[model samples]
Target: MLSPASIVPVILAGGSGTRLWPVSRDSLPKQFQSLHGTNTLYQDTLKRVSDRSLFSAPIVLTHEDFRFFARRQAQDIGIDTTVVLEPTRRDSGPALLAAAMVAQRLAGEGCLVLALAADHVVLDEALFVDACRAAGRAASDGHIVTFGITPTEPSTAYGYIRPGSAAGTSEARKVDAFVEKPDTVTAARYLAEGYLWNSGNFLFPASLLIEEAERFEPAIVAAVREAVELSVEDLGFIRLDAKAFADSPAKSIDYAVMEKTTRAAVVEGKFRWSDIGSWDALRALEPGDAAGNVTHGPVTLLDSTNNYIHTDGPLVATVGVDNLAVVATEDAVLVMPASRSQDVKALVAKLKSDRHNAASEHLKAHRPWGTYQTICRGERFHVKKIVVEPGGRLSLQKHYHRAEHWIVVKGTAEVTLDGRVFEVRENESTYLPLGGVHRLANPGKIPLELIEVQTGSYLGEDDIVRLEDVYNRS
Candidate 1:
């Protein structure tokens, strides 16, 4: 068995979950949202490898837009994670390479790195950990190991891995070949032929992975090495060099290394796993009534069977609906058959083509400080509900074409208008004319909540000119 302290968990948390749109958008993806239970999928993934005896603090690789959210969620669960900010989305190949280099520098060459996707749901935690331990043994013997889930069904959504003869004395076997997602007929044949679903989770020795990457894709290794070398620590995140990272090819780890490596091995994982790629996948995990209906939030079902209904706000009532998935948010509602869950991406594409903001972002936008939800908007006025956490502060900035009115509803607000600084208590209001330098902050122990009304010719976010900021924004 590999030493417990020798394992470093590396989580890949960069993905725009377009297939699960409406609920999952570019601003906040499904991984960061609390979809399954109290904890989000990312939090659940972190908790799986949180055993200090078996794993070290995890390294989270995410996009620049999501760095704060990832850090905040990790902190909420008492996990001390090292966050790495990717300058651009170059897929998992470069991300993993950069993470491997970082892990090697931190824990030496012999250390094993466990790579996992942040969006997957593993129902069986004990079985998952057991498979990790088994993969570690194979990785310790200089083999790059991948956990393969036993095929429970002929699923076309996931790729396949064919296991060969046993690798030494471990339960891991040599990977014969990797197959892409096949048609229903082909998938059935593969399932009957004993093929396993590629779980996309891997365990590899730091030095060995780097060595293989250098052999197969030297350009990727070189670019990522430069990016890592020039990386700088900002706030609490490590920001990779933008130019070098952007120069690297955008490819998945499967294409760049796993499929080409001679040391590839597969470990059979009996744990129940789901990537939660669509609403149908999520509904399968949720508890349903005797009539086969799963409902969340304030939802009422009447004569509904085999339906999934969810609502974030307002009541959603279904009458005589079957085999349907109805998801309602504050600003948008989606109704479709459960079988067409994968078609949500096409719908999102159509929305984006029409320049609909709901396709990419929700009504609520999250910032480093807290969150702001758009209440109403018209031709010349926009209303928003802003929440600021304790010790949170916005940038010292000014808007050119817009004036703002703020009314405090919860805690105290420390306002700085031009050169003047004052405190606005509960139920009090403040105003700033156009081109007036202003900043908002919360100095109290409790969260600060307020309503902001903007009236102007142009109220776009790009109108802001930041003179100073604590959570640096451009």
Candidate 2:
């Protein structure tokens, strides 16, 4: 049961975070990675709203590729949440509209919805919650409230919000205007003028948001309404209608509603917050050593000052490097000046144009069941290490161009070959011929690990024909 006074938290988790290159990718973005601490940014956001007395079960909006990752992260923190799957990336406007519709349906028109991004880091949790509460009061009065961070630096990276007169007896103020990312000089002037950094978080009444969005962008509201209306449940996920959602204009909420709505209000947020927009921003958040060097994962620095070095594989040793960032992964390495961290997006764009897989995907790919990492690949064959969690099952499918040989390395695997199910223990092996329908499942209490060798004319993922799927992958 949910309390009537509880605010509905709508967490947007859909961005690809391209600037944080080698570590963050479309396959697993920065929100899903543990960049700062043990918990991912998404999990940290979930923890902020875990107080059931103040917040209801959150409504998470994510894309199809990250649906399981979002759900699994919620389950990791024991949070009961509603995961809404966006059929396509339609930016924050339609996504929020759809979430507002869901909130209205669940909690009624008067319910307050706290819209937050899943990839932000707030150092002061209590101050953040207090700010949300203050914003909630303004939102309850039918004002669309956006949290504005007190600018600590003249950062040209974030948009600015000019605060106007007070809304009421509360600390909320009318939003005078919203400004785009400015030049360094303009940012300094804005900071001196007491402008707030638009934190990209909002609190609004469900009915108010719907009304404002409908007034400003009726087409978006119409398309998203249809998308939510025709949404279907797939493996416990509410999947918005693809065609309807794709029709909605791809615009941020700031451009679509916040900038145009007359009832926009700003609440001053005193908490320490960062979007972690790039590696430089990330380095700013992390505490450095005596030499002003932030190092992680087997990194040794000699005569390196004001540098950030991180590696997931191999030792990253830097000598006589100043103001540099060297990040390494199993498949890719990025070495650049710390000041040029913003240019990583341009590098990613070039990589994408060049058809490089490392631009958008990591070596390890996460699936609904578990994860698989490509060890090596050749023209006609590829080797992969697949790990299946306990009670996890893959789809019953067959490939048209590939045959697989699975060597069990750990735990037990329940293999089904053309409806004949059998258990293959550790160190055991099984072979599936091309065009043979098969399924792999972990029936044991521990994770099942296997080395899969594929020999085929084609090794692409699209060659699969799913006969039946528990996760509805087709």
Candidate 3:
């Protein structure tokens, strides 16, 4: 068992958010992007629990594809975390259960697990911490505690929690009922009836949560337990057994435990919170100008009223626009009425049906080593700008259908070509013929920047043939 700690933060960071498209894609989700402030939402979440007196080292649960992003982002903020990889998307039921099992195994039976979504924004962190303490007290009393945000508006986007009588002397109250997202009329009535918005964050003792979960969903507990038992350490990450994790049913925590439990409790949270589920929600969180326009990245609003225009691609000038959201990226632009922000998901679904690349990926793709952005691509040629972080290394691989030329723009590049290793300095160039084994790495203290040009009969990512990989890819 591990050392004594009050609460173990279980951060879920594996969501592929589609609602905030163009900026938030499958390649890099909103939690990893600097959306709200200078730091990403995930970093903000990490900072919220960095107080060692109140909490222990966090355990981050994410998908296998986001393993590097989760680990690197935490490292960037100087926060050490235990990264756990989920084999598949089985919803929060199995995810939280797996985390509780892990925490129990490490920190013993009385360890408390706090489930925090990595993508959410909590403005009043002081009040948020206070509420967590209140919830922790209730959880220690054998109650599953969920933080309920006091409703500021009649919002239909979030679920509702009806709190009943008080639980002991703590600020937490017994959960009377858990309600689904209601219609506008029902939402207004709920606001009048003193219901709280379900924030989806939970705190409970590890063993108690597993017991309740087994009482409700025995198979989920069994599968997650076996998965945790069979889990292996992969480069400092815990990779759950794929077959065992996949055997668990896909269900949410509400359906598996909280909604059916008698020991459920809620602590009223007065702090400002936002899930940033849509563009309209994001616009609502920001401050607008005199014309009621929120603009970012070289935007000029002309007679615009209540418009949110953000662009990182080019200068965006709006003329006589109202209640509209214009978002632009390097590869795609989304323009729609701010009121219809929820419909962007349907538009993205249509784009996915049409097999559009922008629906899922961005121009810049992140890898374990660094990042690469496509400058331009044509029928037989592709140009890319790559940035490799200090000490980062790409896989030892080759292409069957393409030849490549790399020109170093920054730092020193340690290049390996056809079993010959050499150093290419700034402004130096190197070439690799078709079917020639090659690898690129940064050996300097600074980031390595390079421009790569590829010429081939068929230019596709599937042409890569990995002879060896440090990340252990197939």
Candidate 4:
């Protein structure tokens, strides 16, 4: 039985997802994108383990830049989530600490936290939930329980877990050791010796985790404690101390605390899970045709075999390709051999060194209100298509240099034009003069779509001045 009194799920939803490039960007990663289905990876994760009667509201830990997107994903999935926005990516230690502090605050000291990564894809949700329940049971005894996926192959990309003697015949066992990703020979030997994959998921009592942190990393413990204790709460999120939390050691939970703790135990998992860490791994999730070709959008193949072709726009036809990945977008087309997919991170590094914005941003970026896609650009003006969710509002803000013209294409828009609020239904337009305060909101039952044309001497995102916001950004 689940300890229903105080069990909160703390999900780590922050990742760069460098390998799954083109689709996954720095701000909008793979976890937030619809990889192969209607729901995103993060949404699937939330839906798999959520049972309102058994689990408390989820506490999500994510990066500061993706806070609005995280909130929107959670709301879309119908999970009442509380977000803990990290000022920077200081690694999983601070991430979990941030969530733990919020978990304790919202639930209590006696709460048990099930820490899960949002980018993981599990084929069998029932078996996965069963494994989590077993771990949750172990956590009730003040033990830090982590699940290990039963390895079906000798894979070098994942770490291994050697399960020791069984803990009284349950699936639980004393974790004999945690090994890093090994070479082919070493991985083969580990598989022969019956080692499991180290899944980065954990279950721990909130107070015990804090206690262990206090003993092992006193500095992190103090900083996180102070950050959470003195934390500001707004709209169900706990913002960590920017300076202190950023100063915390950048380490994974595996290295920071789990490897050193004696209370650590492992529960064998019986679910088919993939981390979606690389394009190769992601390709394995989707089924291919008879010739081993997988295509998302309109695409055709003449001589392509074992190729992963994805197109966000018009038809992408391939010929005489094998074991290759081709992803064509409106702005970019990425082509790589499956074996060389891991090297895309180096390509991203090169792009960053050359000051290319394509390394970090996608064509469409999600926001608290809705979504915006860059349409066209010129020397002095830029055009974008913005969609506002029903009953959604943008921050009351003004641009210092740029003048904006909003042409409503569909639905109704509640416009705040120069401190005067008004509504414009379909096929109407509004204008904001330079140095004017304006905001856009959706008032109808459907999404509000509009074309925003911004023209100015300088049209950077930093030129905005926010006066007030309902989503709590100052």
Winner by lDDT: 1
* TM-score of model 4 (CA atoms): 0.93
Residue by residue across 1-474, what tens digits does model 2's lDDT show? Answer: 224556999999998999999899999999999998899999999999988889989999999999999999999889988999999998899999999998888887778899999999999999998998889888777689999999999998999999999997677999999999999999999999999999999999888888998899999999999999999988888999999999999888988999999999999999999999999888888899999999889998788898899899788988898999999999999999888998999999999999999999898999999999999999999999999999999999999999999999999999999889998998999999999999999989999999999999999988889888888876
lDDT of 1 at 459: 88
Candidate 1, residues 1-474, lDDT tens digits: the string is 777677999999989898888889999999899998899999999999999888999999999999998999999999999999999999889999999988887788778999999999999999998998999999998899999999888989889999899988888999999999999999999999999999898999988988998999999999999999999999979999999999999889999999999899999999999989889888888788999989999988888898898888879998898999999998889999999998999999999999999999999999999999999999999999999999999999999999999999999999999899999999999999999999999999999999999999998888999999998784
Report the alpha-carbon TM-score of model 3 versus the true structure.
Answer: 0.97
Model 2, which residues run further than 4 Å from truth?
1-4
TM-score of each predicted structure versus truth: 0.98, 0.98, 0.97, 0.93
- Which window of 10 residues has the lowest lDDT sum in candidate 1? 1-10
Give residue 301's lDDT in candidate 1 (0 to 100): 81
Task: Pick the TM-score winner.
Answer: 1
Q: Estimate, for each residue in 13-128, the C-alpha lDDT of model 4 and write its tens digit.
A: 88989777777889688888888578988888788768876678787888877787788878876777888878788788877877887787788778889899988899988898
Q: How many clashes in each candidate?
A: 0, 0, 0, 0
Q: Kindly give the stretch of ten consecutive residues in candidate 4 with the minimal lDDT sum.
A: 1-10
Poorly placed runs, candidate 3 (over 4 Å): 1-4
Clashes of 1: 0
TM-score of 1: 0.98
lDDT of candidate model 3 versus the reference:
0.92
Q: Candidate 4: which stretches are off by over 4 Å? A: 168-170, 419-425
lDDT of 2: 0.92
